[model samples]
Target: MAADDHEFGGQHTDIKLEIVEKYLQRYSAALHTWCDAVWYIDAFAGTGSRTVRVKAKEGDLFEEPAPEYVEQRRGSAKIALDIDPPFDRLVFMDAKPKHIAALKALKASYPGRDIDVVRGDANDLIQKEIKWDGWKKTRAVMFLDPYGMEVEWDTLRLIADTKAIDVWYLFSLSGLYRQAARDMSKIDATKERALTRMLGTDAWKSELYSPIPPAIDLLGSLEREDVRQRAADVAGLERYVRDRLAQIFPKVLDPWPLPPKERPQRFSLFCAISNPSPKAIRLAEDFGRSIMRSR
Candidate 1:
């Protein structure tokens, strides 16, 4: 996914949106001063608005359904466009035709702005198209907000290899919890493939899908308890992913486990900046500190 690819549900601080807006506002100002062009790339970008089903309260309607439907929120693409002193160019990518059509319509709303809508898998398009050009003397922000394990590790490595873009990745820790079966051997093959893709390795099966050893009881020969260690939040996944990111990006700003309200069940936004400046570092650290304070 290129941009605005968040899954809708429950309550949120809307911090995810806040983070994007803040970063863009800061990034645009910084880039505009020096860089000839700045690009905003949103992969896995969803349609402008999603039709959400909301519970209808009492006295709400003449004959409203129990769950009322409404188009409630603006997607990232729209939000990014709305930012003042916007990026010099914007790129939107998605696998859905409807989303592509929506993006095209969105393009119409801002007639003169430079925007490109690539209808295809974000992983492939990013590696083949976006990453290849527009990066010379250009600073770019790529928001990879996929709904699932659509972002491949190889693509990330490629981005790092270029070392010209900043990445805002939505890591789905909840998906890991779902696939991390207690009995690892019995996990479905398809899910296993997804886990491997997300982790960029098959070793997670051995690394994370294991039980915590039993502690010694009063009787030395017998174990005290059978305590099975499972995926709880983003500990295992975060460490592994961040370690990999560290190998590439010098600065990986993860205001991780994000505050619960903004966190999607177990998902969090992770940022990887290629070659960060002092101001970028300041903004990233400030954001993390703010989130921690709120927590």
Candidate 2:
């Protein structure tokens, strides 16, 4: 792929980017008064831009149709840099080397901005590397747009412990349902471990599944299938995730459902407030709710 060509989608991608951008613009401006420094952290920062393919419509009989091509669009990292009252320090982390290189180039483009591009897993980087308690008077907004189950529960706990950062988590509802397979026996050791780690609890086995209804066997005996199946549907699973987040964060706003309108729920966009103060929580909730409702 080209340097500026990070993988992205169509309408949903545009909506996700817009929500984050709107929140960042408000976040920086609001915190500038009380807080000395504000930070913007993009956990899975993609090249600071993305390549979107624009499809062409059918042309009239009089003229030939236009061919489809690529277009460069700003990702969350670039959006953060463009905010009116910009963040004091911006950190962009990605596991890919190419993405890191692209982020570096993006940093170079903004000569005066304070930007740090790190190459590492978001979970390990957030959990082990960064100093959470060191931020005394500083506040931050960390965006977690992970690539399928990458954000561990431990990482979220660490972010919450900071007590000064707001989180915009783009959680994969589909990813969770898929990992926790419907057939209980289908969950292998690897899948089991992933579910527990991502959820921070082994209780999912009980919470998400149940045994099937009893059925009559060929031998004319009532038989119950020993294997369990996933009981929670998509909306139920989304609620479970929101509840999990609420346990860690002081406040979690109702998720903005993705693939908008009547489509099946694929991803859920959540805004969680880590700040423990009552006043801070209230204000963050208000801001988050307004932004989501507008979208």
Candidate 3:
């Protein structure tokens, strides 16, 4: 697919790329010394590039000129290929045919490199197709930048079971908050199922909601209503997710809310270490915290 066919890059997109690149560089360098192999997996890898629309500057004409578009900005796939002390294996998986074609083309550009472009659901590819037996001798870093809540909680548990891969998850905060509607009655069965699958549990209903107080009618009769309100706001939603991740991963850094400090946060960029070793957890958190703080 052409780069323009993919979603355009925005401020949040830029920040996500920057943070991942910083972690990849440090991760690859640190593991290259003793580890036999290190892998980089782009689970929702879009085309190897993104398009950025640059607004045209004011001109002499009454109406402003059309905005200019800039394409071919290096994405996570390309960034991984270019890292020094590079990862031994690179995997890019996407469900769309066009995206798969683009990833294959990207693989061709880096000839002789050990890169695998798989076309399938990210969750399925990780759980069923990818080999976990080799995980003992190898380490990996997987990037999960899903469009919405495509990632299943079971997949996260599988990754954590590997005990050798680190993960950078760009969780959709707005997606969760929106799907789990403010009014409990508004959430249908489909939305409830989706929320349960993503969160891996139905406990969110109780943790995130509160019951409405009973009222009395003018006729002196007490009235009881089956109503509930969402008690978790944006920040609360984010905290719930972080706590969920902590259940599986040994170390999860405090995610950096995207569009940084802005209202109605869209995504939470999280860095989690699956490795249980104290050294590994400490190193990953140190790098993750510093990178996010500097950003």
| Candidate 1 Cα errors over 4 Å, as ranges | 1-9, 58-69, 130-134, 211-234, 258-264, 276-283, 286-295
Which parts of model 2 have CA positions greater than 4 angstroms off? 1-4, 60-65, 213-224
Best by lDDT: 3
> Which 10 residues in a row give candidate 3 its minimum summed lDDT?
1-10
- Local accuracy of candidate 1 as per-residue lDDT tens digits, 197-265: 777788776667556676776767656454444454456666777776777776898635545554445
Question: Each prediction's Cα lDDT score?
Answer: 0.72, 0.87, 0.88
Q: Kindly list the per-residue Cα lDDT of model 3 for residues 148-184, writing each as its tens digit.
A: 8999998999888899989999999889988999999
Q: By TM-score, how accurate is candidate 3? A: 0.93
Root-mean-square deviation per candidate:
5.5, 2.1, 2.5
Clashing pairs in 2: none
TM-score of each candidate?
0.79, 0.93, 0.93
Off by over 4 Å in 3: 1-4, 59-67, 222-224
Task: Report the lDDT of model 2 for residue 31.
Answer: 89
Estimate, for each residue in 90-129, the C-alpha lDDT of model 2 and write its tens digit: 9999999999999999999999999999999999889886
Scanning candidate 2 in windows of ten residues, the lowest lDDT window is 1-10
TM-score of 1: 0.79
